[model samples]
Target: APFAAPRGMVATWVGHATVLVQAAGLNILTDPIWSDYASPLPPFGPKRAAQPGIKFDDLPKIDLILLSHNHYDHMDLPTLKRLWERDRPKIVTSLGNDTILKAHGIPATALDWGQSVSGAALNGLAPQAVIQCGSYEHCPDYQVHVTRNHHWGSRWGADRNRALWSSFVIETRAGNIFFAGDTGAGDMGWPMQARRYGPIRLALIPIGAFRFWKGQMRSDAHIGPLQAVDVFQRLGASTAIPIHWGTFRLSYEQWDTPPRMLELALRCAGIARKHFAPLRIGQSLPVPTVSAVPIGPKRCDDRAIRALE
Candidate 1:
């Protein structure tokens, strides 16, 4: 049976950066890609070790799509076309990305960093229609804020940075939701930008692909477990589920290194492991509305850091 919509918030990790977020009477997807190989050429490039958590056919009527960038791994054209043809969901992406989609006959709204679009525009209905709809909370309107993140974008070799990459903050009556779309710990201040939107009830953070050299815990292009914990604390997120790991091999770390290191990092920071957890693919869970309780900053001991090696 197709999944029914939820009145509150429920999230399902499909794999990689794909997550199905059901909240505020909407079904949202983040950087969705269901291709077996994360590449432009079929049967080439990095192949997925596991299938998508929720089959593409089983996805509910998608109300919105949060496309982070134009990378092949993040932006699979076939999947996007199928989705656009089927549901005609409101697709939101950063600057220059809309052109890429337009060429493929998929319409998307482009926004720069710090810009936002209200739910009225997302519904594809006239403002007057939305006002008269008389649904819950005035048709359960929400806002999508395009926030800045440190990441590059390119489909081929020479067109790097032509499109801006971004993260998003979805504001709703229930609570705000932050999707940290494919970011690195650049100056470590982006999380606070998302925090300013309001209390974040749920956060989707990345904790993988940070290792390239052996024993390298962090990367200029990605955040490992240690930096992820810092991001979670700085953002003051109520609860987070780790993504971008255990689905595809993008880095040199062990298969379980990201989650294991995350557990260790959480312990070192004196936070409960459940606060930032890893979920099995295809798992769905409700997110409780939480007050804004910011975890104060703390440095993990050196011995704990040494154990990560």
Candidate 2:
């Protein structure tokens, strides 16, 4: 599928954890993988259950790429190389991952949790003194913050946690966006840390591949629908779009299970269904601008709100 260039603050779910975010006049891709398989080998491992929402050639000029971890599914080297050669987008990932990317001829800036890197430096642009405001044309300075999440990173059998795993908090001119690369509900307080950065306008959270051994698995590395909603509430985001599902058969759950379960979870949590979106493989939606006006009280049932209390 080919995507039209989105004008303002917009996001497109290109399957799995891959999302295309167009905001602040810059285009960003999250955990982009357009390969046929999310495996170490081309012919083996988890083959993509569906094609990427937007074709590679159809992508607009990408300003940055966000990598959450080193899993083959999330870090497809072939696609990364292609994008690097084509768009020369600045790549950001957790610490220790930069060495891996550098060895593969792709340069990236690696940061530890709570550390941040500016897009201007990443894109090789010199710092400017004047602020020329026009649609993203002036290349507004953006900041990508490496934040903590409950996840592990490993590309091979012997290298577990050799590279750090994390989520990202992107502060753009339009608003703040949180991209949970891949995370489990760890301590239930990790999401709260993001709140200090300010109100989150959009949240991209994982909501699939959680069922293991019929619930026997600890699921300490991936989050399901219920936990996703919990993370959403913790961040106090204005809108939430569920990702990391329905693109690959990584678990025992059915292809349509995540969204269906997410709907049930949202209803049970007393959150308005409109606040949570389950986008199609190639769907793009405009994000609401963050406003200073206070939001009115939610319409959730008192009983539903009390359940969390």
Q: What is the TM-score of each candidate against the true structure?
A: 0.93, 0.90
6-106 in candidate 1: lDDT tens per residue? 44788899988899988867788998898899988879888998899999999988888999999887888999999999998889999999999999999
Q: Which stretch of 10 consecutive residues in model 2 shows the poorest summed lDDT?
A: 291-300
Please give, for residues 132-164, the per-residue lDDT of candidate 2 as tens digits.
Answer: 534455565888999999999888989989999
**Model 1 lDDT, full chain set:** 0.85
Which runs in model 2 stand beyond 4 Å of their true positions? Answer: 1-7, 125-135, 216-218, 291-309
Error of 1 at 282 (Å): 0.9
C-alpha lDDT score of every prediction, in listed order: 0.85, 0.84
Clashes of 2: 1
Instruction: Give the range of the ten consecutive residues with the poorest summed lDDT in model 1.
Output: 291-300
**Positional deviation of residue 137's Cα in model 2 after best superposition, in angstroms:** 4.0
Q: Model 2: clashing residue pairs?
A: 25-136
